[model samples]
Target: MGIISPGFFGRRRRDVPGLPPGQHLTEDFPVLSAGPTPRIREDEWEFTIRTEAGGAHRWSWEEFITLPQEDVTVDIHCVTSWSKLGTGWRGVSLDTLLDSVESTAEYSMAHSYGGYTTNVPVADLRDGKAWIVHQFDGSALAAEHGGPARLLIPHLYFWKSAKWVRGLELLRHDAPGFWESNGYHLHGDPWREERYW
Candidate 1:
């Protein structure tokens, strides 16, 4: 709907020489606790979607590219105090992926390989806030920025949209993620400034 604000670090104007017209630089943002740093060889990276009713689907890097795509601008608010403005990202909507599968889970948790998990309501994924992003600023995502594939849920706190995400686990109830279980907020709606709860 609206790509609201910049990310955790600081916002900068797009003034590259010959990059895409509206493309922005998302690399300056910081990666909090990079999480043992998952290494992704071209053949090793994968994205999986698991349903509450026990159905699961996995996508390789190439396969992930075959899905429908859209470019969206969203406001990403990090738990820390920093907001970049008007970041452009391209990817498939989480709802589009869910529609391809059948699930009964009321809530879901995003799972990353290095013990990272972020909980979110199933309805939220259906809303425009969530996406399985592959491109940032018209460029293939760089590894440090969660390249190949990463979750983009801007409405919630940035931690909910994990970097280097490997899969999504649909749950019937809420579960705290790596930061959430520690000290981050449960329902990290930036609109309410619910950075933590």
Candidate 2:
């Protein structure tokens, strides 16, 4: 199962415009994780994308920071039913990273530093839809909030935005990750209320 917080059983969903169904607005950026937080040093951090054809494109912390960066202001929704709107982030677009790799794979498995994984379609990750964000709200993202770098796919449920993201493995078919294997929805689209199998 994914991160589950207490008090989720009885809260009423608010009928707020621009909010997903069955979700309520939240002003707090809650810290919920499947396990203990891993503290990674910046100097040792790296990101990679391994193609289905066995090709790998990698970047060290120094190299990644040198890539083009964008300021993104978007709304984020958590599977736990909390939605925070108009959050600010700065990072490199997934398009920029994918431009260097050549692959025909349609799926990807995002791997984080602490054994966490999540599957996302390559189509959902491209065309200005996603980013690998390192900063949140004008400051370095806190460790509890995915720290050095995290995948930021705000259009989907927050879980798709894997924190402490390390690399991505392009695959020929879709496969469930940590949460999906345990019965979470395969494609976690917040707007559609696709929260469970």
| Cα error of candidate 2 at position 191, Å | 0.9
Residue lDDT tens for model 2, 81-146: 999999999999999999999999999999999999999999999999999999999999899999
Clashing pairs in 2: none
Q: Which stretches of candidate 2 lie over 4 Å from their true place?
A: 1-15
Query: How displaced is residue 170 in candidate 2, in Å?
Result: 0.4
Clash counts per candidate, in order, are 10, 0
TM-score: model 1 vs. ground truth: 0.81
Best by TM-score: 2
Q: Write the per-residue lDDT of candidate 1 for residues 15-95, one digit (tens) a residue.
A: 544223233434367776545667666578888889888889888878777888999986666667555556789988897
Per-model TM against the reference: 0.81, 0.92
